[model samples]
Target: MVEADASAPCTDPDIGNVAQARRRTRGPSLDKTAQTRQQIAEAALAEFVEVGVARCTMDRIARRAQVAKGTLYLYYPSKDELLRGVVEHALRHSAVYTALQRKKGETVRAFLRRSLLPTMDAVENSERGLLARLVLSEASHAPELARLYKELAFDAWQTYVQDLLTLAVKEGELKTRSVSRSAQLLASPFWMALVHNSLLAPDAPQKLALKPLVELLIDNLFSRSAGDNANVKSQ
Candidate 1:
């Protein structure tokens, strides 16, 4: 029989515990790396918002992040990748998606007030708003980054809102033949308003008031009968 390889991990029981201990010791280092990456993403978001994606260079982001330009490369290989990181960072921290959480027996109007209002507020009055506007403005020139933004941010919100509408239909809170269409209808006005404000004059009178529109959507679009049908379909 040949001798065991000297560099191989030990099969001894004590060695296994030691290996796990070493892994535990490395956790702090891993946390530091993640923190550094997040810092870079935040810096990149600031740069993108200030000067837009095309003009936002890796050097600017690296300087803002207080990291070496080389270190920035290690975290994000290109400006496009960095832009995607910016979107990811926003999604991870934004309250927009958190607004989707529904409580037991809450009316659809109550849910909209809790969820939709916060979303509109975030779009109106946060660094997140600037970042969103940057993405929209730059998307035409940078389709790849746009696609990534859609995949990471837009798709997530669309899926969640659609599911919320579907659940509402099942709960008899919404009257709709298609939850997909209903979700689109519910969100279109707010989205359009945000787009208008971001692209047009901020104080435009054409801005859609979220509260009244939400009330109209609920009053005209929901029905107790729809929920009953949904229950029957499930059975």
Candidate 2:
């Protein structure tokens, strides 16, 4: 028999104990970092919403957060990165992701569209419109921010579309299609509608117009199944 090793019997409980100890050791640092980031994001949101991204500055953000300018820099190196941080924080905390993750047995299209309505509502509300305007206007100036926005919105949207399309195929409402293509097919029209509303109709941005679209999208896009085909209610 091989000689026994002292650490060999550490096993699952020992390993878990070690992991918990490590987490405890790291917890303080992680919490502090998160709080700092939150402070920066809160400040950035106030600054961006009031001034628009073009007019917002790191100095203003620092003063608003009550953090030193150097502290803000510790979290985000540049203005664009700060903008991305703020947007990401807002979207991440919004009900959208919660709606997506907690949903079960709901068609992907139904759940995501339902989740998206909150975002649309946020974008459309006059009080909240400044973030949307800055997103469209100032995004062009910052390529990183643009990419972050796209990644934040589009990638998640695409992933959800892929799942919905797969379910749609089962329902026979959607034709058998590549998941990638399906993702694109489902994502474009909604975004197109968003852009149209945001850019054109005076009240469109404010109203969101999500209720009708949710119904229409299901009716037109899915192949339809016998079960729950009449009304695709995410609720």
Candidate 3:
């Protein structure tokens, strides 16, 4: 005890405890950061839906998220950025945005029908529908929101459908003079149904049915042999 060795490892409990606390308080892990970002995006979406985007504010979104105002800004610097983030977050969970692989020997049309129909049928009643409605309702007033929605959602779907149509053409399942136009045609029914059911006739006695309309469009777009058409009709 006369003198402590200079090279000896530190045995101070206080020092060790302080080091451990520092490590713990260094920062949130990557997962925690992602979770927080998602929380903010969801909160923003809720605010935008409850109060139109034009009326929505960062303070409200931060309060809704239970995050500090600075925290919200850290994740999304501006309202337009937040809008983009919210749309991206929503699309991440949408089955329509999921990249599905066609089964071996499955035609592109069949693959699209099988993959998209169920999701499309339920989309009108989901958060996605609400987001679409928000975009449409605010488009005239909030041009930025409209631009983000068009760039992120509309163009994305158009590109995805165009790719499928291109594949169908290669597989001899479809013959179209313009895949781009065909893609637009294929996706038009969903928007029509969405508008009719939500904006035009939310309280209508008979809501538009999306599944049959999409199925009919698919059948019309894809070239099927007489037997295949008969088989589809029989089913």
Each prediction's number of clashing residue pairs:
2, 7, 0
Candidate 2 at 134: error in angstroms? 2.1
Candidate 3: give the clashing pairs: none
Model 2 agreement with the true structure over 6-119: per-residue lDDT tens digits: 122212222233235447666336777788788889778776656655556666777889887656665676665676787678666655456456366575555656765565
10 residues in a row with least lDDT, candidate 1: 1-10
Write down the lDDT of every candidate, Cα atoms only: 0.66, 0.60, 0.77
With a 3 Å backbone cut-off (N, CA, C), the pairs that clash in candidate 1 are 172-227, 175-222
Better of 1 and 3 by TM-score: 3
lDDT of 3 at 103: 77
Whole-structure CA lDDT of model 1: 0.66
Candidate 3 to truth, TM: 0.82
Per-candidate TM-scores read 0.72, 0.63, 0.82
lDDT of 3 by residue, 162-184 (tens): 98888767755567788999889
Residue 47 lDDT (model 2): 69
Which candidate has the highest lDDT of all? 3
Q: Candidate 3 regions off by >4 Å?
A: 1-25, 224-235
Better of 1 and 2 by TM-score: 1
